[model samples]
Target: MRRDDRENWRRVSRRRFIRLTGATLSLAPFIPLHASAAAKARIGVLKFGTVSWELDTITHHGFDRENGVELDITYFAGEDATNVAMLAGDLDIIVTDWLWVSRQRAAGEDITLIPYSSAVGAIMVKEASPIRAVTDLTGRKIGVAGGPIDKSWLLLQAFCQRDHGIDLAAQNDIVFGAPPLISEKAMQGELDAVLNFWHFCARLEARGFRRLIGTNDAAMALGAKGPVSALGYVFHEDWARANPQAIEGFARASAQAKKLLATSDAEWLRLAPIVKAEGTELEKLRDRYREGIPTRPVAEEEADAAKLYLVLAQVGGQRLVGQSPEMAPGTFWEGMPK
Candidate 1:
């Protein structure tokens, strides 16, 4: 062949090799190999509790890196504040209270429930106090972090009213307190009781505080057949739509984490360090996890709707506005791997 013809053949061969390489790469793990090659996104989370674990892991471990994407996370105090930040467009994705998703939707804000994990709150009181039963809470002053829209407090009241025929709001004074203040106030005996989630309640229990009730128990009492829950992941609607791959990537990582927790005691032991509460009270943390992490996301529409409406209605003195209490939208996704 002439020199010019040989050179033309080599150029064609190189172009074909490049095309085959691109096709081969595309057929591999789309996330683990592709997303990280793209761009990094931020995931916002609420810092108050153990519920932030999945996003926290994603943020720290490059939830994006495993899937080929980059992730950054910011933590906030409570769901209300987190929602405010989400609405202001400060977050790419977020994990927040599932109940707040509906509350935000009812108020005409658009957000979705990503439903990554599950947890329940417990009612804590000092062991030395005379409060041995939920009924004993009737006249005691109770402290909760968020005002009325908080699901646990509302569920507590519903369980009390529905099961025992006691009107909690009319019977006990419900005070909204900051997260850090609950332990101090409860220990000081200034507050008769407080509703707490995860290790905070565990801390109280470790400190000789008696738990008159757990949110899970209350959920069963309210006829929740499976896991009655106080916690899950919430994401902004627009943010999730634009960042679907990010959501999918993070969800895949979280499902893997859940499977790890479920199958391996070793993994649980490993996580025990990170999720465990610090201080001498740490034994309480072990006990709390031993009870089990539900990890099942609630349905967006049916299962969680009434719960949200009931809680929010009790808060605002309205029943989801124009919508009937019996019907509402489910905002969460299903089909995460077990």
Candidate 2:
């Protein structure tokens, strides 16, 4: 080959390489990045909380990644620890009741809540007990979980007073204790009736205890239009505003996980070990969890919460509701980021 021809070929090759590189660079804006490159959110959760069920489902199904967020989970053994972590800025999110968020907001903390579950406690008694009516509970020993200001117990008191003309706190022998302790004592027949959390109530139901009255029933009797969420995913409003994508993505992933759990029995079976339930207990847990999933609009939930807040204030006094006689504005976060 001639030297001139070889030089011409080398120039053409270099020109072709530069043109291809420029074309590739032009297409760079159109190429999608991997999901791992998305935003990250740090969430604190109770080690054995029901929230874990939904979170596990999200992780297993890659819902977070699909929604453009990566979840960084930290587990705590107690609710107080998780709350502390959240308040101290160690976590971006935590699950808690909206009442607490309202109290915090009333104190000027600027936190807000998104609905998680409407499940609440119930007045439970053994299947063979003769406590067929609220009147029958008069003079009976009642074990209450979450102390005197517990929302369920306070609601029950208001319900009884209005519907049956009975003041439960004065008429009954009230015993306050932790949820697990109260549940165990109730199982051992140490109390005539027990007002306990929803999960404990489900366990008692599986063990043949009868739900004398659910908190939902009392709420309805007291004028709630539908189920009211007692608990939700709470976070700082400032943080939510700053990381809009992360916050909204987490909410969407959470909702998808709830939908999956609501429909798939196989998902529940996969969660059996974590739930520590089997047979009837598993079924009870599954059904109760499904029932707890929040489906109502945020406006409806906030409206119901406002009504219930007044009821709680009447029964619980300033100690329970803090300085707020009414639920603080922005207690229930409206959907999506602004």
Candidate 3:
């Protein structure tokens, strides 16, 4: 058989194996002792990185069980693919960066933000590098994993333009490549800086990279209050509309999970390994988990994330609010289910 055919067969076989043996996959340990059995709910999780904590909890903790749903998950590369899958109906829901939704809305794509997570991605530089601060980023090359239209890249650019008067679009050398390659290049001194989320940045810092700036720092610098800063969840509008009960069940589970995470730091820490199983060290995992996990259902953070996208839309020559001030502001996270 051809290579593509072989790969396709492998995928089919793998999924079939899961479907056949998933019942025996042993949910005994993951599910809470008190969880009640429920119906099945298949959800797609785009494997962006370490943000699987919420999903892990949903699947493992019997949240789905209690709510009459069995969570079936599909993981993908990043927000782009996840959003595409959502649009194509291959995925019913997706957890991705809020900016993806904003861009989708700007393009008239039918997606909705279900809930907001917290901010975490930050800029990393070698500790010995002469660039000590964000202001020093002038005239230096910066690497972002996602390309130009990425929300983080745009936000970083806005920060530079608004604060230092340096238009990154015009002056800075911003490169897009795989995070591993970027991290390796940054380590070899081939690049002055690289942008990374907490997981990778922690590894960089452990290897002696200094944090030049982050969304949190920029938020403080900009005096942002109730502004959205980073990642969140999205789902197909039609799917959400049609499967209101399923959606409500998922949301209810999420609220419970968020509540548990907020009140119990110890429990949250114990659950970190599930999210960080892809080789993140304990300390780094703890740090990344703590950065935003505790802030689930934080209204101010969600609002800030929506506004961040609106601002990016403005910068990209798109009006998020449709040129009506009252209509625009409310359009963002306006009809979101509480």
Best by TM-score: 2
Candidate 2's residue-wise lDDT over 116-136, tens digit each? Answer: 999888999999999998889
Please give the ranking of all candidate structures by lDDT, highest first, separated by commas: 2, 3, 1
- For each predicted model, how many residue pairs clash, with residues at least 3 apart or on different chains? 10, 0, 10
TM-score of 2: 0.91
Every candidate's lDDT? 0.64, 0.92, 0.65
TM-score of 3: 0.72
lDDT tens readout by residue for model 3, 211-313: 8887666664554473343555667666656666666677778767766665665655677556443333545655555556534344565555545645566
Total residue pair clashes for candidate 1? 10
Q: Judged by lDDT relative to the true structure, which candidate is superior, 2 or 3?
A: 2
Give candidate 3's whole-model lDDT. 0.65
Which model scores highest in lDDT?
A: 2
lDDT of 1 by residue, 1-338 (tens): 99999999999999999999999988786555473354456666667456565445444555456754566667776666766777787776666655556656766766666554345568888777888888787787988865564567777778888778888788888788766687778888889989876667877877788788887677666656555434455666665567666666666766556655455555444555566655546556655654545543455333744554554465445432334343236456543334
Residue 225, candidate 2: Cα error in Å is 0.7
